[model samples]
Target: MKARASPSIIRRSFILPVLLMLAFILPFMFLRVAYLVLESSTLCSSPLDCMRLRLFGGSDSSLIMKMERKVQSSRWRESIYWHLASHGVPKNLHCLHLKLAEEYAVNASARSSLPSPEYMSRLTDSSFDHVVLLTDNVLAASVVISSTVKNSGNPGKLVFHVVTDKKTYSPMHSWFAMNIVASAVVEVKGLHQYDWSHEVNIGVKEMLEIHRLIWSHKYKYMKGEDFEFLVDHERDLEFLSPRFISLLNHLRIYIPELFPDLNKIVFLDDDVVVQRDLSSLWHLDLNGKIVGAVVDSFCGDGCCPGRKYKDYFNFSDPVISADFRPDRCGWLYGMNVFDLEAWRKTNITRTYHRWLKFNLDSGLELWNPGTLPPALIAFDGLVHDIDPSWHVAGLGYRYPQVSLQTLKAAAVIHFSGPAKPWLEIGIPELRSLWTRHVNFSNKFFTKCRIEE
Candidate 1:
């Protein structure tokens, strides 16, 4: 500096430093490029390899096999028998509850139906392997027991279960069952309990309670069990197929894992009945995918009605940075499956809870317990679209014949529409289907008698 270095010397000095920096960076850059190329080659070798990487974290053969085993041993494979009955079994109420019970048995061979009268003594004896009691408007513990006995061919391995609230049972009966039978009654007390603050919130409360019942059943009965598959049905369901047992068995053997992460579950709503054996749908390979939903509108141009609702909630789209798109397909609308393990591990439940809190805190009313948030959270970038035949909304407007034709092509039929067969505005087509498949005359009257 004192000598006022010559221009050439200064330039040379700067050039030397620049060259040295490049020399260091060039090697790192080369290594990065080489690694990327190697990784790309390894990952792109085959479809299975690529899928493995995307699903189980890598293309390592051992890892894939381990993941497959985990899937095979998943809790979703375990047999889940569901009963959705209310408090009082009315004679006229046989329409929905009895139909659902028959459908449940048709779906799962392992599942047995014990109506209330039969359930009382069986609960104390523990005669059945797995028992599910639907308690709502019915107080017929005897009917539940009898239904299970009648539906279940074997009862020695019985696991007594009940889904209801304290209101569903008389105080004396609740105390009696609790003290004598050692029965497990799952009631959603926290967020699921009935609240009369607002009428609009009632639907949300009911949906939440249903979800809670599913979760509680999972934790209590299916946590570590290894079995074929778990199925839940509402009291309003009808069975149109006789191959329900075979289909469930096929799913258990072929896929071996229904919900790998416990983050997902396939929910078949009761309104729809089966036309074909659902084995094909059960065998669908999720390839570690988190959610699979039947495409509601095949038109493909239709949009989700809930898109604008996202803005109202101040929520950001996790998939697209922009506002939530109504056209996005994986909304878990009618019948959906969940990956239970993944769900438990991720913020799914937390997200749902937060969303609920946000809605309640902001004094915003909601319907259906909000299926979108958990759907968004569990969507790991892939959602398989099943056939439309799987879910034909059974609103009376759609002719039952057309719906049945659709059902014939589908693995499962979801009665997602408003008009139910039990309701007055019945679809003559469904009634015809029921007459053809189920012994409606005998079973229908029997159900009525049992309920009465």
Candidate 2:
């Protein structure tokens, strides 16, 4: 070489190469550290092991082995997913959801016959007893109707007044149209069918805002925190489905406004699966009471406070606690007999509006921000407790603990919580109770590819 390369030149060349390598390698090294940190805390195991213990009739080791194999095959996949995706509603499965989009598209319009607009006026025209259901979930409503009719000894003696939101009117009407309940009359109407311009309900927007804001920060409104109380489910907000949080949940309050002619009607939640004949419910006299409901399994009043209604309101305020026994127990919502004719006479709806106005004006966090607290205040002494056998509450919230015996004995099972049978997180053992009612062959479920 021309008197060998100078030492400075050689050192400079080496340093340049080193810097280039560091630039390329540093990001990879950082990523590796992050991956290690995250993997340690990740929930890598599947529910298969739990399912095995719950129902598989197989060995735990075999389940573990199956899990190990699954993890191994998807070893590289985890790295991609861990960096990119969420836990529930896996992206891989979402690819199959095209059918849902297709089914909900414009093609899915009403195919069945609906009653005349004046059907409500001719209350005595139908031979069947009437049951009213209000919800936005077309699928769940379909299940309820199908199951109710299937169990009803007299299908011809059943009339269903299905009320839904504007967007859902098509699907709701469509399903009932294609799948007629034999001789039973199925009526589908949108929430807009009712007039809300009345003076009593004109402030609905403000009332909803008040309920919405305070109810969200329930703990802050609870005054203070207790360690023991906080740790032991006292602060447990409980999971509520988005569907249950809407104005629709509060729609029960407007039954008289929605159906003017019906004297009494059985109200069923969309999540309820009717097993026994609900026609008998129409026969049960509400005894002139405005509402007939089962005891709220989880809420109560202040003076007798345990849980339930008391927990939902800020009883600390004299406005809420005064004469409104925080200790007075409340009732459940799922299956109820609403005497609209009777409710129309009382100031119950007016009282409901008054409280809603109070809660809004003072920002008092009055009753829990939901439909129930207002009902509790409005129907304080008007509710009549029916046989607990008619309704079973809390299936969706407290899953595994719910015994098969209770489910089997109940006339109606209500999944009030977020873990509905149709969702991915639904309890396997309990989902079958709902799925059995779903006609898998139905074009909607088949087109949407909804499987057990």
The candidate maximizing TM-score is 2
Candidate 2, residue 130: the lDDT equals: 75
TM-score of each model, in listed order: 0.40, 0.70
Model 2 regions lying over 4 Å from their true place: 1-113, 116-128, 195-203, 216-241, 296-307, 325-327, 399-401
Cα lDDT tens digits for candidate 2, 1-452: 47998999999999999999999999997886556445433323544344444344546676556545555545534433432221244332242234333344545344434774545544544345878888777678878988888888888778889888876676666666556677667888887766766763655565566556655655464436333222243223441223325777667777877777677788999889988987767677777778888864422233121135566777888877776766566688878988777888999988987877777677655665467777788898898878767787666643344567767888888876646777766667788989898877765566556776
Clashes of each: 61, 18
Q: What stretches of model 1 exceed 4 Å from their correct place?
A: 1-91, 94-265, 300-322, 329-334, 365-382, 394-405, 434-437, 443-452
